[model samples]
Target chain A: MNSAHSDIDRVPMQLVQGCLVASVQVELSPEVLHVFQQDLLEAVRRTRARATVLDLSGVSILDSRDFRSIERTLEMASLLGAQPLLVGIRPGIAASLSELGAQCAGFAAFSTLERALEHLDSAG
Target chain B: MIELGTMQIRDEEAPVQIRVKVLGLLVSLGADEVLATRVATAASELSHRYQLLGAESRCRCVLHNEYSSLLVEFRFTSAHPHPETTDLEGIAGVMRMGRNGTGTDELVVQIKLPMPRDGLSKRAIARGRERILQRSRRELMDELRAKNAELEAYNETLEETVAERTRELTHANEQMARDLSAGSEYVQGLIPDPIEEPVRVDWRYIPSSSLGGDTIGYHWIDDDHLALYLIDVTGHGLDSALLAVTVMNVLRAGSLAGVDMVDPDRVLFALNNSFQAHHHGMKFFTIWYGVYQPSTRELVWSGGGHHPSILISPGTEAPAMLEATGPLIGAVEDMDFPAERCTVAPGSRMAIFSDGVFEIIRDNDLVWTWEGLVEFVDTLRGAKVPLADALLQEAERIKGDASFDDDVSIIEAVFP
Candidate 1:
């Protein structure tokens, strides 16, 4: 297991049933998110799965650009016929995201990768 | 009829002869060669004027360099023979010359041959000799001290010169250090880290030193489209770093115009045009650019004299290189970018890297080919990975843990 520098960086791809499950350890900083936007879009294209579970466990903070990048990724994933499910939203980030009106309700949210997988499995 | 009293040879002598003899005596007490010669000539001439019979006299003197002291000898012969003759004198008045000390360097005695037994003449000669000696000693000491003081002044000047030279060298070194620090900061400022976004794009930029020639930037065309670019100026350090900044600024301005083939190609044209216009004639850059549309999963890319990009598909064991269709930017004006499009399926990866990655040599062999990079990406295909970590590790592994020889910048666009 690559000990990710952050909790939100998704390097080790784990497949859960039909869902592409990844624990993303990201800095949640603007610079990381800018790149994350493109990186996630490409990661989804390669997984060949319709659903994704994102673990934001490593992100200690989230800026406006990061919030925007994730929103854009979710939109792109939807266009690609895959749904992006966010997990490991530390309560602080959850509040920040909600306060920013990030419009994340369009995608699924979970507290952990396992729970997210369970949700995906149940929904499917 | 001037009797000239010298027949007495100052019976003793006449006043003129005595004065001249005294001056000669002073010379003998250690006056310089020129002064001693002049004194002796005056004494001889004075004796001739008197025409004293059998009046024979000689004077010899030695002196030091400063003419401050003198040693003199005086002798006299008289025709009349005296039974009671003595080389002695009685007390005489002291003689002083101007503001200086007593003038004579030494004193001389002449015995009157006409049976004169007076002690006065002996006392006068003895007094003159003593006075002359004291004056000579004082003058010699003063001259020696003056010469020593002049030498000390000269030595002080030499010391000051040495100190000034040392200060100049130290100041120059400090200035050089400051310039290096400023140049380093300028380079760091030129290359920004990857911009963060919610979408999966990750990047890494490492300059070889504090300064580098690599430049990277990204601009959002709208909510769904983005434009990215990287340029590596041709050289290292300050000059190259400045060129990279120039290209970055030009690209940024073009990006602000909105997404169009007209935009990327026009930016390229402006870069080359501006570089040529300057004609300082020593700077140019190799550039690569891509426009990504997340909604369509299409990337329009153009390359100029840069490393080809890697495109990987799910389940594919190799990666494809997007080779340049045009020469490096800044080499021509009004050049066509002719953007290429690649459709990445969900979960595919595209790696954009500088030539610093491919140019690395190991054991005299090129480390890895474009195909090898694609295969590396294929390994990550089944797994969900953040693009930055995977690329950094692979780059480090290929370079054998050696620091990158030049600036290394990599961007991975993951179309999720």
Candidate 2:
């Protein structure tokens, strides 16, 4: 199993400076992706965070399917009262997405998690 | 130098005939297949370009037997000024623009191939040329008769093979599991191969012993129309597969009388009247039938209680779902399966699949929904993995194993 999920039912979400931050670290199986979606939405609803920063620095195999899943998740999270902030996108992943003509033009992305948090903080 | 007579490019078939002549010449001279094909392609392109220069244009092909190599030259002449080296896409060897600064509309192209150890004698060259000449009427009739006889023998053999396989399955019914093991190749032979030209089509089919009777096929309805469909009959095992194949044959042959099967909705209506569940072995089928018109770039589709097919747009816009909501075929007679039409832009893609493509049981013991499939495929635009393989892989991932409980069929067509 190429599942990055350490636990089946749990998805780790942390809060820092009144914002929720979750860093994706490995290739996620379909089950893990579903679980992550559920857990992220629940955390957003519970903490009522203004911004949620998702870091993708550790995920190297970012294929189109995963990229699209992340894109949908971001839109869903935004609808759930949390401004979704994507950060830590590797250069290779970005280049691949553009090369394959993936729809990356709709969202604004950041180079680092701290930069994302700083933007959120300054916006506030 | 053997001056092979020049032929006029009267129509589209002229270039093809010219290609055949050059190919035959090089192949007879011991040129390798690759080199022969390249030189033939270059000759055909050069001649085709000459034809395009207006009605007063023509090309002559000459074969020059040299000491070390066989040199082929295409001498092109036209009343219209030859523009910029007769654009052959730089396909072959040495291309000389024109004649001795005469500024005449003549573009000469030369291609060389290494000569065989023993060069052909004059008599042998003439013999080869004779062999490559167009066949006489009597010769064509003789070839046609031979081909027809061969086809009849092949059909008889195929029938015997199918009959023998069926008998073995029926006799080993008590040992059904063992007999079913040999059915993988038998089922594979019924599926169509991937098509590349006119319209690019590819599909993935995975059959488990417990999940049979899913068939996907496409055929030209006319010179400009193509019919694409996926049919899934009820139940499992060899009986259901036979039924599916029967229905596919019916569709492929367009044998449903009194109705034009080329129209998608009409085909469904006719099928409903023909294969009712209660009357026909308690089996009903769900099918998504669509027709593609290359001339109009239109796709008209209708379904009998099957899942909606997805049409991915050309650009980054979200995909349009072609909803199909009629009742299952054979479940109800005279069911009006309404058809809808949409224009397919260049670079668009269509994915018509059975329910098994998206309706997988997840690890959480929940069946996947069409919405999940929509979102998944939406991201699959510009995906690294091929569409059919990617869908199957994702289904296996969701199910936690490679074994599928139902037939997994995905047919993808890309319009360029």
Best by TM-score: 2
Candidate 1: C-alpha RMSD to true structure equals 48.5
Question: Measured against the native two-chain assembly using Cα atoms, what DockQ does each of the candidate structures obtain, in the order listed?
Answer: 0.00, 0.01
- List model 2 lDDT by residue over A1-124, tens digit each: 2255433434457988867888787454345567778778888899988877888876543444456777787778889878888788766456545543568654568998789888987888
Candidate 2: fnat, from 0 to 1? Answer: 0.00
User: Where is the poorest 10-residue window by lDDT in model 2 chain B?
Assistant: B83-92
The estimated TM-scores of all candidates read 0.43, 0.44
CA deviation > 4 Å runs, candidate 2: A1-124, B1-174, B362-364
Q: Model 2: clashing residue pairs?
A: none
Query: For model 1 chain A, where is the 10-residue window of minimal lDDT?
Result: A1-10
Off by over 4 Å in 1: A1-124, B1-103, B107-198, B255-263, B277-281, B358-387, B394-404
- Please state how well chain A of candidate 1 matches the true chain A, as a TM-score: 0.78
TM-score of 1: 0.43
True contacts kept of each: 0.00, 0.00
